[model samples]
Target: MATCLASGLGLRATAWSQTTDGQTQAESAKADPSQAEPSSGDTSSAVKSDTTTVTVTGKKKAPNDRDVYDVSKDLDAKTGTAADALNKIPGVNVDPSGNVTYHGRNVVVYLNGRPSLMLSGDNRGVALKSMPSAYISTIEVISNPGAQQSSGDGAPIININTQRNMPPGMFGSLSARYSSPAGSLETAFLGITKDKLSITLIGSYLNNEMDSRSLSQTSVLDSTDATLQASSSKGEGRSSYRGPFLMANLQYDLGPNDVLAAAFNYNRMPSDSTDISHAVSQAADGAVTNLFDQSGAGRFVTESAGLSGNYTHYGQKPDETLKMDGSLARSASQNDFRSANTYLISTIPGNTGTRIQTHDRRNDKTKANMHAEYNTPIGDDQLTLGAEVDLEDNTINSRVFGPADNDDNLMVNPLLTDDFRSHQVVSAFYATFQREVTPRWTVLLGLRGEVLHLATNDLTYRTKGNINYSRLNPSLFATYVISSQQKVRFNYTHRQQRPEASDLNPHIVYSSDTSVDAGNPGLKPQESDAIEARYEFNGKGLNYGLRGFWRGDSRTITTVSQIIPDPQGLGNIVTQSTRVNWRRRSAYGVSADVSRQISNKLMFSADATLTQSALRNPQISGVRSATSVDGGFSLNYFFKKGDRIFASYKRVGKSYTGQGYTTGSGQANIQYSRKLTDKFDLELMVDDLFRQTRTVTVIDTPLLQTRFVSSRQSPTFMIGLSRHFSRFGPMRAPAN
Candidate 1:
């Protein structure tokens, strides 16, 4: 399926707040009515009351700088991760694989103000899938980060704010949820606050399993339109994961003007998966020519831990502050895979050739980061200066064995093992200034300079080298207020994505019986220039927005495939895929979103987007592009006694990648929730009502053409119950 239509009428009333930042709104007064002392920027060294203070009102409000999503207001979930919640936000999209895109461009995710090691690489999707959304109080979507944010702000950013001031007592929450595919989630939160110290703890566990099946067809043809080889196969696989995630934070008030904090996070995931597929090849005359069957099973385990500390001092003046944060982390992973295969000709009743292979791989990595920023008021403008340093050390090893009793076949593919090591260091400094040119206009500009060094070595191939590159990233942001309820913003930013260590490892992986994949150690980093325009309107209980963006990439890394002659020679060849530096790529898109309250009991929202992307393959001297249209709508109904009913449907269009083009599709969900009591609730949900979720891929070339489809068309129903208790008193509606 390349596209799907999803439409639904919703009923329910909701409100949107014009103000941003919980600390700047009146809700803080409702959350804390104890006449407590001020916390944010109360830079008075000596104070009488040592009671716990709230920082929600910190610094001065930045009215024209960023867009903020108050998670508490827009979503109320008994069970779901931040990734799920983020998918519901306007102008944001999260693919089935949990890759997040904002305005048609990739974004960097941060916890508080620091980079989250767990939210990068494969770990990003998994960690976000398991992370409890409740831990994040707010999400700031910064389209143009200032120099003070340095490297992190270079690209669009998703900053998760997890810290909240605690009242003068101990409190927390406990929750458990179960879903389809035999998946379960459990979480606990505990916080304690004294006169001068605040302690918070979070613990969670996830046990999940999922399965899917697929069928595919492939044909190899000559330039004369004659089919040389045709094949078909059916495949299925199941995967399971069990893991524990934990975090702890400690904050102490050194005085009224300064604060000290430390935090630690850890997680371990153990997984198992298996797959099997069989295919038969036919000649142009429909005669069975060859048979191939393959099966594999594998186990993977990963572990990560991190510790960090922070010191913040609010200067003894308005709009002045100094903050320093540092963190260190370690992550390690291992995989063991085994497979068996058989190949035979039509004339042979028994297998002509057979082989068994075992593959083992391990990776160990360590990361360290430090950041410092200072902000002060200069005349009517604000200036920020910042510096940061990041370091990474990684080691990987892979080994393979074939046919316990065979050496002839092994020698054909002699290079079967390798040890790879990589080291990376990055240092950056930046400066930013924000000026209010007039009563209704604001301008901001920043520049960041970064230096990066990468070194890699391959013991098996005796190849070693070092790479050094540096660039200056600059950004500009401006806001023009048309009125109290209307405003327009313009933003331009430059960002970079460095190639991962895994991408630099020079090792060949037999991904399939007929195909192999390898990395390119000489690959360079990719850079992007992004520009966007946005307009927002909010008034009379209505919220609407429009946005457009264009992003261009240089030296983009892409995968290209070619037929390699098999060393066994028997007049056979195999397909091999390798990564290389592509010439360039570009994407641009426009989207709009509107949410309105139809009545006291009915609310409706809708969003649509159109995007086009193109890439230039320097190796092939060819260029290809694709366009997609995606959209979704939702309805909500609120009844008495805190009861609600909701319905929604979303569709995503096809995506173009270096490998091939993917299909587009969507799903529908209907849910009803009832408040059994003031602190207890029940929910029933029917998801994928139409079973429309399907995956399809296509690859076309002069000599080969292949198409594969995996239809995950299954209906699921779930029932959940939850209980909540809070001594901190009334819960304010989350900001929108």
Candidate 2:
């Protein structure tokens, strides 16, 4: 019987939050004392009488219980970062490798709700532009996640929910920004609460400078005996970046139903780059043969850290949770390649030749996790049980140097170095059950069981040892309440995705077309089978929703393009790379959203999404098919007593980067705010009003096909001012 229900769910997951009337029902549900009506720089407490509102995850009942987009009043009139306030939600998107998509899939970021260490690369855009979105307060977009959360393949999660009381005393904020074509400047500092324990600190300083120029033209066609070739290119570039960040958080409230929390973070990035290039080639009675010239310089660095903990009880009606976490990270990079080549050969002699290359890389990572949850009810139904444990460690080191004068650089190969390591362990058990089969129908069932173990050491190339995997995930949900404001839902899930540790470490990195990117240890592990359906409607001020989804996978991991044989043997020429796999994939989607209030003070909203994807590889032989779309719209207006005005529009289309396609983008934004008294406030913003330029195109399979273009150096006026203070001091001691 599933091993006695997974060994009684790990012996009740460490005694399910050790009770005491479930810590007084989780401190009266975290004292949500019906709050609302404190605007003018809010200070909480107000709501003359009850306005009844509660809809813990949809199904009727919610005439407003806080949150309709409010990131600390748009970070007191915005200034940037946190992906510029998550691009004002409404179908979210953040590409350029900072990856963050919604409506187009892939989204998973959380910070008070857990999971966040700047989600990889470019430090996730320098930790979302150096924090301070007024320390966020709500930004959830779970796009079909249920099964009590935590899975891979299904994507879309984006939690973020910070700022949880600390205002009975001290508060904080300080900001600054400037940009003139990437000659950037940004500053921030924030602090909070001071009695009964609570503290938050944030800091950021940045300097980015840039200049780039380019021009290109190309045409080539060769059919058996038919041939033609023509090409031209010119380029110039300069780059510089300096990033600094610090984050701290602490909380203690051990008394009113125990609580304690701690966190710390740091980031530093240093970068430099310079380049120049010229080229020309022609054939087919156009003569020119070939001519080329180039130059370069580069550098990089990164660091990260995190720690976490949580505990709760609050007696009886389902209330109990416990969690612990830890993390650490490090990075280093370098590249210097000086090049000069001229060829037109009139006799294998003199044409000028020079090349020098040096490359280096280092990385380290560590992680730990623990979990617990409990809520009981059996007869009238309603139950939840959980258990979890996870651990990870990774390391990579690389080095290379070439050029000792021709002969293919004296047959290169010496300095080539490599070292990669990995270790992972995961264990889980879960159960959930809910019922009320009528009274408007409701039913939920969930089950999870997992075990994974992996190990590798001194992996210098292919083949190493140790591996084990196991899984059993299941879920089902249904809900109906066709009146009093409509509602309907259905869901099914089975998800899994494991194989990260640099995709099974086997070291070799450094590419941006200087080729040399490797990793593959006979990779495997990927699973998914998901389904969803939803419909909702709420009146009064109107609100709407519609959703649909389907997913299937059995071994899926993409990014392929190969042509090896250059393990420094030099002569046999061949290089063009990228790898990772366990093919076979499928996807389907639909989405819609609407919100309105055309009267009173005006309001509006909109959202849309569509998707389709397929890939069934045979070592990939062109089985292409894909589609994706995005949308966003917004409007808001309110006059007097605090003021407000806003407008927005966003769109994205043209997908497929697994070697092809990209060219569709749009953006628009406008804002206004006021309140020049009772603690100050003033703001103004205008961005990308109509500026667009984002491109992508790739195809290196069966050899040769490339196109790449990039943009995002944001510029477009902004101004902000803010001030607030209330009973500043005393309240410490809320930790357990």
Candidate 3:
């Protein structure tokens, strides 16, 4: 089971006193005509500052080219992670598993306009939560992205921009929270910046503990046409997690057009859990029959670190720019489990067995990329051309051990120890042209070509294999202004999906009494063709949008059970079974959202999505087609100077969980915040306020099949206070 919660707040502060002073001096000189003449006389030797200013009253204005989505203005006061900030953008959403989707598709996330540590494996969630929202300047959502981007499963492109300027100063924030059933968390951040150099640091710690209880019942029948028995199971589980993170960034401006930036990030997470279950069966003769009891405890620890350096050259003809970025990251996790079970039979003495298992895994990844772009203009049109080359190498190692009851000694299999390595290289070239065809009509043309090569090497007991694959993807988009306040756009793209290292290895690490999972050695990539159309309308104080999209994929990958056992007597092993052009899927969906400021202190936003998808596979009989529909709505109100109120509700209809059968879930949240003083604030939050129980039901159709149903419910509450401090100067404008 996966729990969803945001981590502590970590902020990176930079000092910009010199830049601020420059701006202030520039404004003063502009006001005094006598001083402006000398400043303009020496054009070649004078400093030319890069800055802009705008005034805001009661209405919103269009964003500038350099301005991404503003965090303070775009997100609700209750948002926690950067993911929450990104989701507020049009055509952007984050799934329950923490995967970000754009325009109902997948997208990659970039930090500071470069590929960072967040793009890899399971670290995405941790990275998102550890980064504080206050440190972010803006988030950009790119739908039909260019070819210079990394190629992967289709996802919207998201770029997170950090604050670039603060007075030569230091600032930080502290916060604490608690949940009724989930747990408690505390986080803090601090940073310092000065002159032409700036350094920002962040640290956070979190502890989450959860307790749950459940009951289930099942009936089984034998192949001899005889009713075996009915069984009832009751179980309780407790789970807890403690995680800490530290990150630092340094930026030095060599000159007005040259800069060097370095960053380092580290995270450590430790978790422990225990589960106990007992089952009792009633015989056909109405007597107590077989009884079984099982219990297990497990501990897991993961640590990851990343380091990267970036050099940028910003001065060149046609406003050219070149960026070189390289990064290395490594992570490791260890898990241990201990279990004991007793089986009772009528004729023989009860059999008792105990097993202890441990698994240790490690992953190391390195990536390097270079990007160059040149911008030029022809007549009234603007053209930009860019190219990028990226290389990534990843390696993984795993070891597992199991021991018998009285032996108290663990045994390792020579064949089970395995090492897997994967290498990928992507080269892309792209160009974008924007032209003002007419006063009321503007056209933009963009094209990108990408070539990808992936190679995987597996060294394991059961199989030794190597596989390579290449792919080419293209995309196109267009937008037209029907009127001054209305616009329409259309986009189309073809994308590819490559299997991860863990999914491609042919190894069996762990198994249960009834179910076993094994990896596949010969898996192929999947391709998708997607298209979408959208329209937007901007009025006095309201912005509204509607979009429709359709996606079709080939060679879709799905896990299925194998009919035969492994020849090596690995017991009932389940391997990845490929359908080989036997499966086809198509989905279409539409979404609409509206944002408006009802008054000076009140704002409202709501969005809804509805989609229908179908799967056709002849090889798998009795498979039913399913559809999913989900949406959410939110309202926020401000009052009494610095107080805020928020309410939100989300619903997910019956959706397939891949194990055959459908599940439904929903959640609601309410929060309030008040400013106790200029530097202090307090907040109260409630999660799952409705206490809605999420349930999943499974039905087996084959002979001797059984039915099982399970449900889980949790509700929590939290209260917190936040404070700010500035060492060098008074706090500047609140971070937006």
TM-score of each: 0.86, 0.30, 0.79
**Candidate 3: worst-modelled 10 consecutive residues by lDDT:** 34-43
lDDT of 2 by residue, 3-24 (tens): 1000110111111111121232
Residues 1-736, candidate 1: write the lDDT tens digits: 0110100010010221223322334332211111111112112111113333222222232534466666654334555567756766655666545677764456888887677777765567667767777666667777656555545333677877664555556877777767785777787777777766778888888777767687887777788768887778888888788799888888777765667888898888888989898778677888887676778899988888899988877664455668888999888889888776667554434345665667777888999999888877676677888988999899988777664323345432455567888898989998888887876777888898999888998877889879898889888888887875677889887877677786777777555555666788788878778888989776544677898988788888767776654322222235677778887889898889877777777778778889988987543347788898778877878897777887888777787875467787776778787878766667777767777777798766666677788865232676666666664422322110
| Local accuracy by lDDT, each model | 0.68, 0.57, 0.56
What tens digits encode model 3's per-residue C-alpha lDDT throughout 139-228?
A: 766654544455564555688866544446677777666667676556676666665677777666767676666565544445554655
Question: lDDT at 685 for candidate 1?
Answer: 73
- How many steric clashes does model 3 contain? 9
Looking at model 1, the pairs that clash are 10-635, 11-636, 12-602, 12-603, 12-636, 23-56, 72-734, 73-734
In model 1, how large is the Cα lDDT of residue 37? 12
Scored by Cα lDDT, where does model 3 land? 0.56
* Error of model 1, residue 347, in angstroms: 9.8
Worst 10 residues of 1 by lDDT: 4-13
